[model samples]
Target: MTFTLGPKATSAGYKLAAFDQIGSTNAEAMVRARDGESGPTWFATTEQTAGRGRRQRAWVAPRGNLASSILEVMDVSPAVAATLGFAAGLSLESALQKLSIEANMRRAGTEPLQFALKWPNDVLAERQKLAGILLEAEAVAGNRLAVVVGIGTNVVAAPEGTPTPATSLAALGVQVGAEELFKALAEAWVEFRGIWDNGRGFGEIRKLWLERAFGVGERVAIQTGTTKVEGTFDTIDDTGCLIVRTADGRRMPITAGEVYFGTAASVGAA
Candidate 1:
């Protein structure tokens, strides 16, 4: 009924603040961060009335979904802190594998489900999005900034109408709960933090991420700025940029874009 730090998290000095409902956990974390709250803490809620994701997409969490934000005062710059997206993605994937589905019953006629990482912070199960991660940074005192990592996972039910195909653990015949997922995520964060090592170990992070990445060699379309580019989903660069190989054999390194796997009509949310 309450959020408490696991053994690893507690040893790492992490804390959790649980709420029954909130406008947005990230908003609350940012507000406190702006007020000089440099916390290695987490702001979690049972429900969110005004949850938002990347590009300000409205996130709908119907009670059983997991909606939480982890705020950390980093010594790195805003640009460096942006790499938390990758860390968060890897962490979420680990958490899901740790406690994703129930084996007693199967949904979608699948026995054991799997979770994979999509570029730019989305986690997928059998190619459908099961969770997403959003990273934001707010300048605090001096050169340091407070990085807020927001995670939204579909638990009991997936969104009805979505740009991309959506899925939930329950839909996959997994009976995992939000609290269980959150706790696994908190511990997973601690486990991956050493590999991150404040970005010094990014090379390893990038390598591990690529191993669990989804849509590695699939045809994909990306909408960048006002231009749209279609190509094969090549490997992500060492710096975490999505590399797409066009028809002309030219490799394009995209830093920021909305990527959709498959056809033009398949251009969904990122």
Candidate 2:
């Protein structure tokens, strides 16, 4: 399982440890990061046996697709830590562009295939899902940090039991190799980290992210714990909270929840 990228095959200061099979690349990277393994290290597997998504949902990854996780050391606060999800989305958008997926920031007042960011993570190609991200953080020695960001993108095949209409890069007529996509994502993350480090924080990334946002200003639904809120999508704050404007005109900041959007009649709620 060799992972190489482009013509020059530039390594992004991260060691790639590819597995023919593993339970989860994130889980494996977590183990390595906690045991004094210096990161940013990447773990990619051809077949992930027990891949998990947000909320413990099973991520069905076949052998030929991209299943990878990256572990890095950071000194940011928890608030900044939360914004890594958007950073992941932006980085994936870069990788998608490299793969020729037509994943770009749509202009204002333009209606393309609305590929948006759902809350913290998850890139949507139209209303259907195209990619997912999961960020896990652990305390290291003396205020230092280790965070493993897992990314699962459908390059060749999508699982059957997904509730929404899902698509793959190949399905969208973009045939990309797994190794090439991984390298592109690593390079993209390098640029994303720069945005976070320059103290402009996620503001720049948020602006670019919003341009690609699909359901902003539309009627949407969200579920947090036992509470379900229906409201109009508003803006994203610096820390990546989805601001929902209720019917009564109150702006609610949602920290964590499942989000959905559609027409007023068929607004899908997960």
In lDDT terms, which candidate is top? 1
Report lDDT (Cα) of residue 195, candidate 2. Answer: 79
Off by over 4 Å in 1: 101-110, 264-270
State the C-alpha lDDT per candidate: 0.83, 0.76
For candidate 1, write residues 1-270 as lDDT tens digits.
Answer: 566667898899888888888889999999989888888889887688899988899986878788989999889877677777888888888888867444534445555667789988899999899988888998888768899999999988788777678999888777877888888899999877778877887788889899999889998888877778778989988778899898999999888878788764254533
RMSD value for candidate 2 = 4.3
Off by over 4 Å in 2: 5-12, 101-114, 198-200, 264-267
- What's the distance in Å from true for residue 221, model 1? 0.8
Candidate 1 at 2: error in angstroms?
2.7
- TM-score of every candidate: 0.93, 0.88
Give me the overall lDDT of model 2.
0.76
The window of 10 residues in a row where model 2 has the poorest summed lDDT is 103-112
- For model 1, where is the 10-residue window of minimal lDDT? 100-109
